[model samples]
Target: MKLRNLPPLALAAAVGVALTACSPSEPEPEESAPESASPSAPPTSEAAPAAVLPTGEPQVLATGLDVPWSVAFLGETALISSRDDGDVLELLPDGGTRVIGTVDGVVHDGESGLLGLAVDDQGRLYAYSTGEDGNRIERYGFTGEPGSLALGTGETLLEGIPAASYHDGGRIAIGPDGMLYAATGDAGNPDDAQDLDSLGGKILRMTLDGAVPEDNPFAGSLVYSYGHRNPQGIAWAADGTMFAAEFGQNTWDELNIVEPGGNYGWPEVEGIAEEGDFIDPVQQWSPEEASPSGIAVVEGTVFIANLRGEVLRAVPVADPGTATEYYAGEFGRIRAVTASPGGDLWFTTSNTDGRGDPSGDDDRLVGVEVG
Candidate 1:
């Protein structure tokens, strides 16, 4: 069922309290060295200016969605997945919506529900959802004909991934090699992040049919990398460099340059591990500043959707240390961000998801000219 109009104040109030109380805690401060004693620091080479991001007000594309989580393009239209409900909706060009189909057996709870959606080169649709067995991925055929847009019965591509009310990492994407890649959480078990045998807290690389790719770092295993807490965003640059955004415990959130079999220090270390086998995040943010969710890469820049920060962050792929925040607190808890076929950036708000204060026109999909 479509969700329209703001929920009752009582209901909204109760939900907001619960969500706020359960939100991730602020990160602890790290120790650092003192500043140089020299009267004047050495001059450094000037860096290039950041690329211009989309400006002006965002055009609302579709509204009245029930916790839209992920968006994928299907020809000219875009397909959106609702997290609380199993509905897969089509965002039409005229700013209308249509229920293409709903996934079966989705277990909607706290943070576990229908999550990520991806479209392959062959027009096949892949979705990640929490189910009775566990977190799973399903592949379906899509028919995009006008007035007949629909999704067929899904075939389970992968299953048995860990699931929990929180930390159910459920972002799926098609990599440059045409293989399917999935990011999974630690299922609320910190130890799982360091376990190589478990699929939790790791990125899985597999064929479309769920078989482990031969070139995978761990032969015959789906684990691409280990020691991830709860990664929710993954994107590839033009040069095929992969990047992922991860949630931290009570410390730094991370944006990492994903490498094959790379170990991202999690429970052992939150953000940067100055000296260890673990790789440091290319960029890190305080949990309060960035509960980063969905991300998109456009023209060598990474656009990150911040849940708590309520903003869109643009980080240059060449120099990730330089990040600029945009649309701060104007949209109310941005959840999903995707690059449109026309090179614009499309993002969805999560205000009506029982977390943030819902505006009159909330839970919407908005477009901004990024190109």
Candidate 2:
């Protein structure tokens, strides 16, 4: 959600303007063709059958969310985080929602607020939020079931991460190794991306208790990989390879296959740099084409939610660079995407976050079939 200063005309032309939760009320005005058009339909001919693209419609699960940032599952229920309001809401199977708890000391600035969320096998909940001091991760224990849920006092897992108005990266997930993995931005300072000693601009690995794992790439440090501008999505494939979605400054957004102690070359390189020392992104897109936010891997495909692109891109795990656009310009400014228990994809819209046009049901959660 960084890069907030781009002109609306440029953004609208690059990616269509945000639509309502369901669809666009009016047709978008024609503009100059973008560098690449959204995947087009195959031409029909008597010689051959038309190609069939992956097709699935989004079902709106819940509405009236105020900038819902992340979604995590606790059993069959879904827990959603509201960025500006610091509220954690529980969405039941019947589409009912209830406030489970409000995170204390959240500062809802330009792009900093309550962000990423994760749940462990023990049903413990983890949240990343912006506080007065900086960005912090907190763990909470849940007491009740879906309808009536109560959260315990939050236990601070980690703190002292740099925070800023724009680039405070905030995505956390439990890796397949049973360790906690967190992504942090450069806090609006590009130089911080190259500084390995700083916690900003890196993927951090730690135990559930916030202790550095003994097998970490960096001995006695939590830094797993360095040289990232603002990475907001982390998901592990069944084979244990980690993939992250990152926001680029102005030129490129990246989908990176993360390796331990790898350098991504942030300030030095934006997208695919054939430079010797830097690891290139598996896939790259223009920032206008993809202000990519949250990502999830389901059934061997990586589903990336795009904010500026206004689409859910399904990229096959075997094929990294290619993607099929689903619901392009339909759900509006997708902020978070996660795999549901039933093997479907659940995502949230960000139209209410002072950027896109808000429909009456703006910032809602929608579900789509993945397989």
Candidate 3:
């Protein structure tokens, strides 16, 4: 389920009150999360549930999760996911979960929490989360608690991502050139969508350590592309071109090619054929068809996870930047999806947190073998 709150974030008020009432000083950051390899990634409290995959499934590689948010393959047999609350779990193909510990102090208000996640080529796990301050990306060692990873001190990989009740941009991924690309939301400020200085409402490319890559569209800056309302999902095909999925205000949602310095009109434009120097969406849809979130391009197919639509929509990408939808309506409140090693795809459902009533299970992790 998604969390909803008022626009512009009442965080300053809420945080100030919390601080004055609690600790007056800046809160100490959490220690790195510790990793565990006990076969599964679930908290020890719940017993493993039965594995559930499509009937003609690829042998249901695994199952039994506690609100799995984002899934990324660790090796040939294991993967990792984050619980909506704060717990991170490492799942095994045998349907078992091991609690890898929690990312402490993640303000789980509304549509925020442990949202977007990625494990880079270096085997480092990166998580874009809602900290007490706002939204940020933190990197971790592949196997431990938040503090145990390389950036164990919770070093800010990227900071100042806009986080609101409903439209917090949370997805992030490492591109082929070793730069970290992130999708961000407008934080309910339409004007902010056009502001390059504000980190909200844009796609940013930065170094793994949060530093601006030298060759970024804007020199010494992180903004790779701008003009987005709530760009939540990002993906890249084999050729290294980038594409992003955006949430619309009311008119239409969009899928756009993320070009360097490109502005895909927001506030200024909503759906189709808008004027000005803005790039239009390659495809558009009503919110019911694609309240899209996490995205993964597997074997030329863009797998987009829809939060409201409750489906996994696939768009085939023959050219790196262009695509056309091929499959839709196959999942339920899918919040996160990713391509696993060896050509399999993993997706998570979001029915428990507060959306539609989960099918008794609330949330789940399913594997898809894409063509």
Query: Which is better, 1 or 2, measured by lDDT?
Result: 2
Query: Between 2 and 3, whose TM-score is larger?
Result: 2
lDDT of 1: 0.80
What is candidate 2's lDDT per residue for 68-183, written digit by digit as tens? Answer: 99999887778999999899999864455789999999999989999999999999999999999999999999987768998889999999999998888999999999999999
What would the per-residue lDDT of candidate 3 be over residues 1-371, giving only the tens digit for each residue? 00021111232232221112223332222221112111121121123222122112322233445566677644443445554677766653235566665676787777788876677767777787888788888877754533232223455676667777767787788788888888888877778779999898888898888898888989887899988998878887666657788899876888776789998898788766546588777677778756877888775567778877666666545422222332233335777777666556667766676775655433666554443
Winner on TM-score between 1 and 3 is 1
Considering lDDT, which of the candidate structures 1 and 3 is the better prediction for this target?
1
The Cα error of candidate 1 at residue 337, in Å, is 0.6
Give the per-residue lDDT of model 1 (tens digit) for 1-371: 11122122343333232222211332122222122111222222245333547643355666678899999976656889999888999865445678999999999889999999999887889999999989999999976585569998799988999999999999999998999999999999989989998989998999999999889998889999889999999998777778899999887888888989999987788887664688888778788878999999887678899998787888776666657777667678999998878677889999977778987656877766663
Candidate 3 deviant stretches above 4 angstroms: 1-64, 77-79, 142-153, 319-330
Q: Candidate 2: how large is its RMSD?
A: 9.3
Mark the 10 consecutive residues where model 1 has the least summed lDDT: 29-38
Stretches > 4 Å off in candidate 2: 1-55
Kindly report which residue stretches of model 1 are placed more than 4 angstroms away from their true locations once superposed: 1-52
Cα lDDT for residue 368, candidate 3: 41
